[model samples]
Target: MKIQSASALFRVAGMAALLGLTVGCAPQTQLLSSSSVDRPITLGLSAADFEQAAAAATQSMLESGAVERNDGKKHIMVVSSVLNDTMQRIDTDQLVKKIRVELLRSGKVMVTTAIGLNGAEDQMNTAFSELSQSRKVDRSTLVKQKLAAPNMSLSGKILQRNNRVDGNKELVEYYFQMTLSDLQNGLAVWEGEEQISKLGSAKGTSW
Candidate 1:
């Protein structure tokens, strides 16, 4: 009877140890939080002005009605490189992407990712060919067809200027410009620019 009791307790302890180990080895998820504090913030140009400029530019192009469907086909567009001449590091692609999205929403323009800076847009093919062994699949048997070339391309740049006054305030102005070019003629059919400015005191230092 004593031996049996001791064996039962040992088995129970072993099972409990195994369960504890499993739970300890399991992955755990952590939660994080963020906070923001209000401080003295000023803008040389108001948010309303920035929004109005963007809206006006978009409206001007739409009202012009210069962009039209390509004989019942979606107008295709490719993205070109953009130059940034600004004091601050900005992602020019973000601005261009917004324009692309708006154009797409209007159902007037389609973007082509198959064409790129070096000419062909499909990097997957080049990567596969460069591999030691060819892993090319027979596309002839594939059902889905490739898309047509784009009819237009989009490109743009951002420029900035900074002015410092005797006071603690500094004025920073940025210009966002974009161009929609006709792929056939290589001429820009539509161009737009939006400017944003901000004024604020220098942080952690005196003027």
Candidate 2:
């Protein structure tokens, strides 16, 4: 029998590893703490980062009395663009969704799925309204409704910075900046920034 060359052996081992991955030994999902402290560190942006920031930012806004009104009615809010300025691909909605939920639950603000920066967030609103106008549908069954215009707009940006801490370690910093503005006056009502930083091996990649 002839012995395989070094490259051939490596190729066989790689193929075996790939086959093993396709069959089993996959990673199991583990639940993580949403709290900012006592959590595992990662190179890229994480769910914990968004959750913590959203909770804190929402609480701060609630305490600022920006959403309060004399009429005892909740403020209507529309979500705007959330720019991601990090090196890694990320879904900015994770942060916004948490904040939206919190604000809605607080009973101080209501998020409109009928209006958005681009268009309606829920297309069902458009479809249902169009169906109501159709002659095929009974007019008595359809109730005339008016869509509420948003009084406030929310926008934000997520930014990242990296620097070498030492010969063997590097530091990465993330900044989440958000602003709430009044649609009528076009003035900022509330603004908040949350920063998270971590130190890791210099060879690590954030992206």
Candidate 3:
């Protein structure tokens, strides 16, 4: 009985040591800082870049007094096309979403997702309209009641420029440019641009 118990104890200890070794050998996955972190020397756009650019653009727009509502009502805004003129494939919404969220939180602007340059972001509104029309519901009660024209429209473009610094290095620049236009007057109320540059190796592609 004593010998059997000793063998079992040895087996348990070996198993525990093996588990410890396995855990220790495993690579530790860590979370990096979202707001600011050391970026790789690559020309690709990152989440940090999008966030910073959006923040800067929104800040400029808000501080310029261009987003102010005169009648003490939240200004209805529509998002127009944000042209991506860069070589890399990126969604413009990654940057626009941040600005939209901030503006909405300020209670000064309401971004209408129901209408956009590409089309309606939410098709439910259109679907509902069709349903109401088909059912012969009161048009004044549903359509006119919910219909609101945007007072302002926001449009922008993202551009990229790449320059060869040397045989080993390259300089890449990205420009985030935005304009807030008055829908009624076709005037640009606010314009802002944010540029980000990175110096990196010229080996791999920036996309």
Candidate 4:
């Protein structure tokens, strides 16, 4: 067997190091969280918490059979007034989006972005409606195409409760409450609440 020279060995090592660095420093593709991974518990609402809450709410709604439309078709759902009662500043869509996605997949409901608490979810749709009016489009044709009113509305609130466990520890409870209401009858058909609690040091703020 022939032995390699020190200079040649050093050059090979340098090339290997460079290759390792290049691979290690390469940007990794980001992806949505999977169920197998353990989610971190923190002071504010987290992605995992939102996901769990959404899952629970959706499951409850589906099981209750309240999402069934009188027309014998998929219920048109309007997301409305998901009030944020907690101290944390969070877009309610973080939770609603998951529920909407799951509900759509189940083929039981369809969320209308054309209507919402804060006007329409799609500003372009609203703008197009205005343009049609300005252009003097036929009223009956515009009404048929531009107006699909929702049969049901989904609304809710997020509440937070805190209690001191000891001198250094505290227990925080978060409640995710959701309701599905019949717009025509003005009654809540389905309601669900999921609570998630966390114990952490009281030294820092959770909001």
Please report, in order, the local distance difference test score of every candidate based on alpha carbons.
0.66, 0.90, 0.88, 0.87
Q: Candidate 1: what lDDT?
A: 0.66
Instruction: Arrange candidates by TM-score, descending.
Output: 2, 3, 4, 1
Model 1 — which ten-residue stretch has the worst lDDT? 32-41
Pick by lDDT: which candidate is best?
A: 2
Off by over 4 Å in 3: 1-30, 38-41, 133-145
Residue range 50-103, candidate 4, lDDT tens digits? 989999999998988887667768888999889999988999989999999999
In order of appearance, the predictions have TM-scores of 0.61, 0.83, 0.79, 0.76
**TM-score of model 4 vs. true structure:** 0.76
Model 2: per-residue Cα lDDT at residue 10 = 86
State the lDDT of candidate 2 residue by residue for 1-207, as single tens digits: 135587788899999999998778767777766565767778788888888889889999999999999998989999999999999899999999999999989988999999887779998878888987689998788877689999999999999999998688889999999999999999999999999897889898988
Alpha-carbon error at 90 in model 1, in Å? 2.5
Total residue pair clashes for candidate 4 = 0
For every model in order, what is the number of clashing pairs? 1, 0, 0, 0
Q: lDDT tens digits, residues 1-207, model 3? A: 999999999999999999999999999987776546555445799988998899999899899999886889988999998999999989999999999999998889998868876677898867776766565776657644386779999999999998988788888899999999999999999999999998888886778
In model 3, what is the error at residue 127, expressed in angstroms?
Answer: 1.3
lDDT per residue (tens digit) for residues 1-207 in model 1:
999999999999999999999999999965533221222234433334434445655566667675786588778888888787865455555555556667778887777766767665566644544453434656554444454787787777767787786666677777767777888998889888877767666442211
